[model samples]
Target chain A: MHEALRFQPVDAEPVDRADVVAKSRHLRRVTEGAARGLSLTIRGLRKAFGDNEVLRGIDLHIPAGQFVAIVGRSGCGKSTLLRLIAGLDAPTAGGIAFGEQPRAQDVRVMFQEPRLLPWARVLSNVEVGLGRERSSADAQARAERALVEVGLGDKRGEWPSVLSGGQKQRVALARALVSQPRVLAFDEPLGALDALTRISMQQLLERVWRDQGFTAILVTHDVAEAVALADRVLVIEDGRIAEDVTIDLPRPRRRGSAELAALEGEILKHLLEGSEDTSGL
Target chain B: MSLIDSLPRVGAPKLPKVDGLIPWIVPLAIVLVWQLACVTGFVPSRVLPAPTDVALAGWKLLLSGELVRNIWVSFWRASIGFVIGGGIGFAFGLANGLSQLSAKLTDTTLQMVRNIPHLALIPLVILWFGIDESAKLFLVALGVFFPIYLNTLHGIRTVDPQLIEMGRIYGMTDGELFRRVIFPGALPSIFVGLRFALGIMWLTLIVAETIAASSGLGYMAMQAREFMLIDVVVLSILIYALLGKLADSASRALERLTLSWHPAFQKK
Candidate 1:
């Protein structure tokens, strides 16, 4: 346990522009870009818990490599939809399919909280989803590789208690990425971080997604986050998709850029107006 | 008086030091009044000896080694009984907590039997076991079982449902789920049961030995009372208190070591 503190000291540098582009290239080489154009098709995905109807026929198709953001009020079944797709929870009716595969293993979900096991070292928590059957040495290698990708390569042996909020989330991100799934689903993974940390994570995620060319769906309540990160923003209203607005902004879009701000306003107006369609945007 | 002075004393207050002696004042006053009454021929000394006489008798018993032997016997019996009862209680508690059929079938009987004091079965147990170590062990086991069983059951049932669901979602096998989620989550409560059972085991052993026993602290106390050796009885009682305190301190240390991960115990 005393040796566990060896990885405690770490420095987090912001992702450089050239590094982002190069990392994306590296990811494509590794996965052979098999994740491109992988779309999610949801058909009449209905669900009810006893007398309470949480989800009412959520239907949408996410085109491959498209970054889609789902936004909604607290009880709009937004999380339930993510859970259904991640195979964490069963749907009452209807179905969700990614390509031909239906099981949740193909899609990885990053939860809001880091949820790292207190007893496990930083690298060990990242390796947990890799299945526990592997020898310790093999698991350590895989975990170290994942941690390196997240820029925390040196902190592999440290206990998670010593990590900052941003670093812990980075570890969580590494855990999600270790599986190398085709589709990535994030349930407000950065929602709990501070303002500065949240922005940094948002940029990090955008870089990773671009590099890997994976189909990603984010569930967030922040309109700015939705507009900044998504190829298209879908508003979940009363258990249904109220609006699906495509964002025409180019890559490496700034948060307060004129184009992105205009798109944020449009999404926000639609959300607050309780509009059923994106006619204004 | 010398031993009492050896104990650390807090700083004196501005007011008279009388308050420092306040706790002992009442007991001391009562003793002084009783001794005075006895000397004045108001009450017979046979019924209640002076505190000093009791102390002198107690010192003699300690020097004779009779007190230590009795205490050792009682301690051994209690410790052995606790290990046996605690082990069985924990096993049954886990089974009943985890299984619906087992819990339903046994819960009613356990609840009923737990309410009946272990001492109440003393006559029956002695008749069946002939006042041997078996009867004493049985009494201690009976006293220990209820707390250990109930606490273990509570611990198992109280595990966070969300954690269990998380295990299932993560594709953990049933064995993995129990080991990772259920066991750790229930550990704190299980320890609670174990400690309570241990403490009760000692108490019950003393009670059992007092009623009928060839050699034990409780038997020594009863024999001292018959022979008017009040000092021996007092010495035995003090030893019992010391034994209980020792067990409690050890359990507390174990608790702290095992639950080191809890936030409340963060290392400075």
Candidate 2:
């Protein structure tokens, strides 16, 4: 029990291979099992904007309730891939299906900017994506429920204008969940917040993921964020998946823990140097 | 509490909150000065009636119910025209805002029509509709249309593209997208059009009523001018000012009601 307080200089424990292997196996099993159960299949997704060719012959599959993070340099088509999956933009070719269903509306994306309607109250903004004919009271109740899940239940009547940056993002998250979508996609949702706020938000996101089981795909530039939240981190380079690292850290992970830090360093090394072969150990 | 302690210690200087009396002071001072000048006979009565004479004329007209009748007629005509014209303008503006095809089809023609002054069309309108209430209504409608259309179109076009993309990614359909993202995004501009349309409607009504109309404040002013009833003329002008003040106040209240969620309307 005393080891829990500080195990740094006095008792620097050696890294446990059994612990790492257990965490990795557990996360991989859960995700792989979800894939088998949900049957989400992606085959050769190609997206082009004019002649830019943002996503070229890309392919990826996110299992149900699995947190997959896509990290790459800017303009590497990570955002384009997320957008295509979210149905905000149509793919030039190829297909994505949810258990043989070809519809694109099953996915929902949370943006980096909250994009809350300035005129709407926090509750209404959260209710925006709810169907039109649904009663305002129903929407409000759902929004309130979602906010409660996100730990922001008391701020229903507050205007979006007055919300802090972090609070606005929470509202956005609540909005994405209000529909109870099967697939939740995030496009660098915490990119704009301060460092402390980003860490807190990352923790909130992990907690939310734990509570609500849905397929989550996060596109981000931050290697730490990917390592902290994702079941597996996929690095996109030059319009393709360059590396897919299965995170070997246990849940409720600390930020400065040696295991996480080592994983961060390894991921950074792969990101910084292109074409590094990273076969699983 | 001492002045320094009681006063706001932040930002700009504290504006005196004479609250009730603040708005009244300038107008009251102007009236007092005018009344004093007239009472001292600094101006001839034929050229400009004393404040008392104008007040008495106002009372006589009020007693006869003519002032209220004319004001009511003008108000009804202007309001109906404003609503109809403003509605059409708002719809067109939104259409133009969202679709490039609509913009391509209507932009040049609308711009051309906007350049034609509603007053300049007075003769043509009079010829077509025969100096009747229809002509007056048409005039007001035409006058109110341009400002509302311009503002609404500007509002819709200026909506942030990033927000619209976010709405789409959130699984919002087209109608929901328009209502949630487009409409609210363009509301401040819409309000500008609404308020501008209202002001221009009042102005157009007065101008329309002035030309060959047997009833309304503008007609009364013209009739009083012919008879050299300068006090009645002054009272008519005063009535116009009062009506304008009422329209402006109502529009402002509507703006406040419609835009209460806007940051501009929020209390510090």
Candidate 1 per-residue lDDT over residues B55-171, each given as its tens digit = 677677678987667767888898888878887788889999999999899888989988898889999998999889989988887788888899989998998776576566555
Candidate 1, superposed: residue stretches over 4 Å from native: A1-38, A100-105, A132-137, A151-168, A211-213, A274-281, B1-69
Highest TM-score against the true fold, candidate: 2
Global local distance difference test of model 1:
0.77
Error of 1 at A232 (Å): 2.0
lDDT of 1 by residue, A249-278 (tens): 866677799998888888787676845654
Sliding window of 10 residues with minimal summed lDDT for model 1 chain A: A1-10
i-RMS for every candidate (Å) is 2.8, 2.6
Candidate 2 lDDT by residue in tens digits, B191-241 = 888778878887888888888698988999999999989999898888888
